[model samples]
Target: MTTSVRGDQLARLLGRWHALPGRRRSPDYAALAAAVRGLLTDGRLALGVRLPAERELAEALAISRTTVSAAYRALRETGHLTSRRGAGSWTTLPHGHRVASSGLWAPDDDLDMIDLGVAASAAPVELVHAARAAADDLPRYLGSSGYHPIGLPELRAAVADGYTARGVPTSAEQILITSGTQQALDLVLRLSVPAGAPVLVETPTYPNALAALAARRARISTHGLDIDHGWDGEMLLGALRQTRPRMAYLIPEFHNPTGHLMPAELRERLVATAHSTGTELIVDEAFVDLPLDDPAMPPPVAVFDRHSRVTSIGGMSKPYWGGLRIGWVRASAPLVQRLAAIRVGVDMASPVLEQLVAVHLLRQSADIVAARRAQLRFRRDALVEALRDQLPEWRFRIPGGGVTLWAELDGPISSALSRAAEDVGVRLAPGPRFGLDGTLERFVRLPFTLAADDLTEAVRRLASVRHDLDHAARPTWRTPTVIA
Candidate 1:
């Protein structure tokens, strides 16, 4: 609850401030706002810590001071953060004072912010064509009431088949389609978590998940997943034993931000624990199908379960298009029915048009995944090479399956460096964006979702900032620990 000041205190508060991987330049305000909002919802930024001075931070980031000012002003208007003249800016609780909406555009016309926040790339051209073709069949469904809350039967069957093809045999009756993973998650939370009950979340889990659960007033307990070892079964078991949460949510395959896969052994153990504790396990496989290669990656945790204690969530967003928000949850038929009921009260049903489109896209799922993996691999390899060549001082864990790299920055400048990166028209997510105890302070998740040219330029700017900072701090290096 203590306010963070400048220096190390401020540095600690600025966790996960670095630019995300794959972007060649800064993203627009909306993208940047989305990233910041993620950090805020994840509790990465404490409720009230003063942000660095706008002008000073802009200089450190190497961009115009106006850009930093504008970013801060925009965030202020969103109720995510606030600023006072002499007191400085800090994150605000949602109920404190709502941020005034800053319209829908960035203050400057020329500012092209390349957001490294999301790890997804645009959907393939084939998917687009398929979508158009699917539209041609939509007229046939016009005869029905169009209030298909249970989702299109064809799409549901395809989703079920996709799971079966992946080793988890599931029927269409086990599937309840929602608009997207976001809606799917919301519906599940509604079906499971009671208001104010303890909900377990992996530390540094997806931020939007935090937003959804928190909005429902669920008490959250965070568990650790040491990126260095992937995920420690022992640590998770310890948290499970200690919290006895109503449910434990995880991203078992190609985890967000960290890009770690849950080991099979650990998955079995977790299932055992869940059975004993009566805790529901929600495994989000949004990124499971994203490895640049390796189509036959690890199986879903749901497949190893001895009981119906797991709910598997899949979406076309990450592997497809962000705008194509179609996702489904596979659980026991009874649970599926419950989720469907919950969905009706919230959104009624997934849009018929989008579901139809998903059905067509699913037909060529293998080919689409193949192309996506290849493109992502190229980008991922390029990003790794650039980082190795430019920032060798940093250590990183090369992720085998996802779009982001979990890196260990050589110095303790995670927070300061994030502010620095931001000043240079680069938006990054610092290490702590994925954790709570500040354990990921020296870590950063660099996504490989940008074009090669843009990736090169972004790395160049980041390297320059590190060089300048190192050069400026050289004279002070020789002084004694307390001599200055």
Candidate 2:
């Protein structure tokens, strides 16, 4: 069955579309067609999503049925939509069109191509041991249908204990396991955030989170995060109070790209602000286990959420390996059940085998985290030294703990740098990908997840690209496929 978006939902998502800044004066049908095309390009109107009937949408937008019919006809002519007499129209991407889902880290066969684009790590020996243990434990689940909409009991309890040990009170009933943090985030957005509802996020936050927000067609307000001075607590609180957003998504622990950890005082203030504003806080802690400099860890953001307004998402992707496909959400038992209910219509649940392995891995998390931190520290130092040696003009603060560095360039040529770096076999995640509407042009995310020597080589190649950029033609605008 086709997933259909209601006319009211479409109207909400397209708020002020007709009066958007810089939109040229055009006929109503033409403008409507252009807005729908923009949504497709932005990955907000997903491929295969059925559009509302022309009459229904016309009523929603207060436009004539003739105008809606013209708009639908225009979309069909441009190959953006398909229709049938009885079946409604659905969206499609033209040939060679790229969107958010195109970006994922696959093991590259080309040794010549160095992917600084993806921020992930190789699996350690512990994964192998865990898989074997899971295999031995598999028979116990063999008699069942292998469906676990919430998660396996063992993994949920282990995850709950982890939070409890980290100074947050949690129970297994509160944990909702997922395929990855991405899935957990998607599910929460579906359950909590309404279409066109205001949602607060960091200016240069995680790109995938931005993509998820787009997919949900959320109205996003942003707070800036500075590399030198972590967060502007005043600005964050102000946005919460003023916008009164339905939800706020934050990555305070080893924040992506910038890698600035939020201070305990700021987190406390943030929770209080959320409470006062009646806004739910969605805290992403995937990087919490990878502290490189041994900084005193702050309590999880959920600790201060006495009303259970905070939902914390954790996964084995960063601290362990992305290939594991195990992630979870910690919230009130009621919310967990709600997520599971919504999830049943989606994938139903993550694989039984993956959850079993996660149970074993979580049991040995302390050792796993220690090993990752040590390895990452060595690689981080190598990257820092190489950047200083090769490209002295590029400046960045070494992250306390995270897979990537948010480096500032002397000019707003990050997109150009990315294009040029590709010629020299280095793939980069340009700063614009992590920002709203092509902002953050003077920065780029450099992942230090590779081996120490490989990280050094990538920087050397980037230095060469900078030298070439000095003499090359000015670059044109292009939204490249995402990798993070």
Candidate 3:
């Protein structure tokens, strides 16, 4: 079934479409077409979704129907859109331009290139050993159907035991295993939010999480964070009290892009405020296990909530291995039951063998994470050093735990730089890829997930790309995008 995008919804997604810095103003029609193209290329607006009517979109954007008509006409000529007489216009890509790669997907053709697009590390050797051991345990379940609606019992207990050890007092009944945290979030969004419902999220969060919210067609409300500064209490409190969002998705443990860990006091306050607003917090703890600074890990976010208003979502993907594709949600048993029922209509269950492997790996989690942290610390340091040495003008804070560095460029050239870096065989995630709207142009996310040598080389290429962009840039009003 084709998803339909409404006029007002398309207007919000095409925010400030005509206000691109450093480029001369084009006709409104041309500018509108370009913004739609960017959304398609970034996978924010998935192809094949039917768009709004020209008159409806024009009214929503407060533009002339002629301009919207011209825009849609141009889009069709370029094969970015297709329309039938009765059927509305749907997003479609031209033949050659259709092969888009996202943060989760590496282009199959770009095997030799460096990918700083994804913040995932290579699987630890321990995972391989766990896989071998899991094979031995798999035969025990082969006699039965492999379909586990919620998850395998052994894995659920292991994950629940993990939370119980961490002070959350979780039971196996509260755990519902998923294919990954992405799927976990999808399930939570399904249960917790309805279309056009207010849902709060950070300004520059995990891109995939934003996409998930978009998929649910949630009315996204934003709270911002700075890389140098952490969360803004006043802004967050105001958002909660004003929007009174139905749900809020957060990454308090080790925020993606920016590695700011929300303080324990703040987490407590936020949880209380969310409860007051009747907001359910979907806490993403994907990077909670990788602590580079060796700081004491904070208790689970759910521990701070007295009302049981928090649902903690996590996976083995970030800390252990993405290939495992095993994750779970910790919530009230009734909610877990609801999630399992909802999940049954989807993929049904994660792969039995991968779940078995995750069970073994979780048992040995301490040693695996210890080794993983050592490698991350080394690579993070190397990436930081290379950036300082090669591009001193670039500003960033060394992230204590997460795998990425959110760097601020001297200008709003992040989108331009990402494209130019392709010539150097390095793929970079531009800052706006993490933004809710067309923002964060002065920043970029660099992952230290590569080896130390590759990290150094990637920065070297980035420095070259920055140097080239700096020379080619034109004089313009470079308005800084403020977080919060």
Candidate 4:
């Protein structure tokens, strides 16, 4: 099946190819279909993108074409891939859930599934014991019908204390507790966003935030984070000045996906930039507590702004157990009030028992931080070592702290790699999942928070897949005909 590769067509797809990372140590044929479907859902690979012919990819990957063919056939049956007799194969947007949905098993259904998609770690032992003890005290709050929207006084004070400990002064009244960091994000979005206004966001950012803002009809304009050197301070300030956006969302400390920390100087400049443009800044600090090492991070962006343009969002999901269902917003007193008022329509109130448990956990947060920091550091180092050994072709900077590695695949193999990974029981978040228009296709985020054993296996399976692709034979028709 040799198709001529036109010079222009090859150039068009050249820089657009990306390789998704593998999360399984070994391949499983039965599980491959569902995993590939997830890649489609997660926006790692999109519809109509051409896949490398089986033999071409297999020879390039040093793997058997039979394996590649099986994976492609599996995807074709699921409507994730389309093959024409002579035009070759291309990725497709799944048409319906009947195929992919039926293929997906609940996480509980697959006892072997390892979730590298979530950034959370196992719950801290001390917090668990403390939560148990706090449950014993839950009935005391039952007298009030348990509707505590502002959160219990103890929890708010604990949160306030956390801010003070980090050099930011705050009062309990300035805090509004919510269901989780996600709820905090939603509350702030409702209170601050004016429909149709532009919001400044970083490229390769948290996807749900983008969706929430879009749902509110807020137009988003993104500034790219330099994957090679981290966030470009000059570029960010320039974007703020040019757009003068209504609001800008940031994850300054231990940023997600890229793990780039904007320097304290940049943080101050960013806040200043926002103020100069009359733009409000919303900072998500969910991953701030998961650094590989406790490097001295700058004060929260909120602390540097004398004009009060910054709103801080925090959550228990990343730092502690995600099951806590507790998160809060710290803003100016007026903003806090506004958020609280808007929150009532979403849910009358958050669960009081969870707040109580979070308060108990808060008391021991320092200990929990110490334990989590150490454990994550180990996983980070382990993953880094594995990548260095098995996939030396890829390049990445060692992130100071964070759960995932933002890696440049060094070649356009992300989509094909993702498909190949699915042939084994692995899943991934393609680089474009964090960017718009699939701009970061060559980049992939690999979480380092999985168990050491699982991390090793995932890397091994990934290496195997890569080996297969490297050795597959080339096909005559390599250039796919773009469907008009």
Candidate 5:
């Protein structure tokens, strides 16, 4: 009933495992056990995959047979592996443990789970008042057919005036409201890029965007964005020239997960390059208003857009609330009309009530942004301090103005750690979920939107799991391999 993993295949996978930077004191046998357990927990080592024979693995890893014996014993004792004399050893989950699938949005039923995946928070108090005001104003639209695909005129004008105030000089005709940014992204890709055309994306981007593009069957080209250094301008330009993709999607302002803001000069360069290369640049600014510390962030990337090649998508999900479901696209009037026409076959139009509430919320953008920033700053600082105190081995940068911190672990075990954390009621989105080809095994995105106490408790639970992995006892080699 078990599938065996070849010695060479196991060795190849194990070669990528590196010890946590500061843990030189940990014994080699214990480290090996931890690494194997991590792979099992993360689903990389499938349940019932028989491990290589003890002597074979020892020789392949250049370690002693005794050490391999000790490591395998440790794995069996921890319930990550089971062994028998004739059947060999196989991987498995620990008793009472289960894997929880993660996504960009968490399910409403996850109230008992401590969510470290989503970077969203509760709706503001102003939202309720706005909803009430919207209800009062809803009657004005009752007399009409209520099928404004281009958006309610008042809301459209307000969105345009907002962009113009920020120096983009937009008109109501240049705006098209959608259900949310995800919808805006979908409509853009469906209308502009042909099915087989190439599209560029920044690596470690929003997963839903990747999903949307993949659904369109668009050939995806990627440019890596560094957590420490922001986007590589020359590399992006090079890719633009080489691939000549029909569209390039970027999250330049208060970038999600990484929290790296694109500089004004870099934004200008990107806009110019996209124009010259005949590529439409789609900038997602969902997190633009969620600045934590810096008050002097650059203007929207659309400010540098002269040729109308750049389209900006802004949303209320992150800044105001995820439940609002209000987002807009800013592009040329003709393009907006085309997108609106395409949207007709979709939902036709976003709900009138939500749009009315969005108008009220947009009118108070500054105050809302300022309040969210202050609260987020507190949460971010608290989470950072907790990590330093409880889990110093985990390394991460202090993000300036975003809801999440892209934390790097000591080894390629993020998925495993996430699995372990789930047993203690903590849910995480592992590093690979943010990457295109499952390359970021050593990283995890931790959102700071939860309360300070919840963040502390979540880290505590994770530290406990790490401790157990480090100190679990080695099992006897003669026990029968267990399937459950």
Candidate 6:
């Protein structure tokens, strides 16, 4: 019933594993154990998959048998692996692990389901009012063919004006409206990165960006973000100098999952470095307006950019409403034109009515930002307190501003716990989904976007499942079932 990973496949996986960031003084055995834990957490090493024999893996990795043996022992003691007297060791979840029926972020038909995978909430009342206003304004655009591939002139001006007000000195010509930040990213990558060209990304970055870059066949290079210290400037600069990638994707305002705001000095330095190295920096400001505590965050990276190397992507999805489907790209006029030209093969234009709604919302940015900050702060505190009270073993930093809290589990069971939580009508995203190489198995991102009561109940359910997983007898391996 155990599925054995071929020695060659394990070697290939280890090749990718070497790219994972590590501390300078950490021992090899510890790193190996952590890497294996990440693989298990990310589902690359499926539960009950028989690992290669100790000597085989040691030879594959060209490390001492003692190091491999020590790593395996560490994993066994942590409940991530189990071995029999004659049988070899097999990967496993610590007891009580159940696979989730619904895929991560997929809608569940059950009304009672608690969704913690998406860091979004219900639309604000302002959005409803704005939509109504947009309906009234729809008639003004009826005279034309309604396809504004470059976007409606008014909305583009408003977006540019918003940036100018924030000290970025943008003009309407520099902005191109898209459906959302996702589309903007796709367009940028398509237009910028050639196939197999090197593209730099932050480790534990937004998964969708990774997907977009991969779709373009980009050769991805990564720099790690420190959970406690935010980004390592020296490491980033070094990677930039060495890789000299065509593009670098960053979430500088409030990073997804981690929520660490990039310091202003670091931002300036990164812009300068990327400019010197000819790496166009794509700054995602999706969570820019959701600052829970600091209302006066530093200006966008474009503000520090003198050359036309930094491109800022903004969206209404996180701050105002995900349903709005409105976002924009801020770059040079020529670049905006280039993206719009490429966008023609896709959707010809963003919806005119939605662009109107975005304009209305941008006009009321102050009130919406204030309201969202207050609401998110309340829910964030509630979720943190509930976790502390019910599940103190889990560790997480209280994010200064952002929808989700990236918490580290005491053990490498995030994937198992995600699956089990789904069985109890709770939808959770496993940790590895955020990383490019299926690392981060010891962590999970929990959003505070849900209501306080729902957040508390979700934690309660997680606690119950953890108790079961911790106490139940070790499970026996069954025939491997391919996860659709």
**Candidate 5, pairs of clashing residues:** 73-475
Q: What residue pairs clash in candidate 3, if any at all?
A: none
Q: Identify the runs in model 6 with alpha carbons over 4 angstroms from their true place.
A: 1-7, 10-105, 471-484
Candidate 2 regions exceeding 4 Å error are 1-108, 473-481
For model 4, state the Cα shift of residue 382 in Å: 0.5
Clashes of 5: 1
Per-residue accuracy of model 1 over 1-484 as CA lDDT, tens digit each: 4475443443344434444331214443333444455445434554566767776665554556676677777787767677777778886654463323521112222255445655678878887788798889899999988887778888889999988988899999999898888788888898899899888898777767877787778899987767677677788888888888898889988788778888788888899998888899988889888875564566679888869999998899877787788988999999998888777788787778888888888888888888888888888888888988889998877777877877788765554455556555555666655654455666666778888766766777788887665433211000000000
Residue 222, model 5, lDDT: 91
Which digits, one per residue and each the tens of the lDDT, describe model 6 over residues 340-405?
999998999999999999988888989988998999999999999999999999998899998988
Off by over 4 Å in 4: 1-41, 44-108, 470-484
Report every candidate's CA lDDT.
0.72, 0.85, 0.83, 0.73, 0.80, 0.82
Top TM-score hit: 3
Distance from true location, Cα of 453 in model 6, Å? 0.6
The C-alpha RMSD of each candidate to the native structure, in angstroms, is 10.0, 7.8, 5.2, 9.0, 7.2, 7.9
Winner by lDDT: 2
Give a tens-digit lDDT track for model 3, residues 372-450: 9999999999999999999898899888897888999877777657766766778777788787766788899998888
Off by over 4 Å in 5: 1-111, 470-484
Candidate 4 structure quality by residue, lDDT tens digits, 392-446? 9999888888677788986655655655565565666566567655567677778
Instruction: State the local distance difference test value for candidate 5.
Output: 0.80
Minimum summed lDDT over a 10-residue window in model 3 is located at 475-484
Question: What global local distance difference test value does model 3 have?
Answer: 0.83
For residue 111, model 3's alpha carbon misses the true position, in angstroms, by 2.9
Model 2: clashing residue pairs?
Answer: none
For each candidate, give its TM-score against the true structure.
0.77, 0.80, 0.84, 0.79, 0.78, 0.80
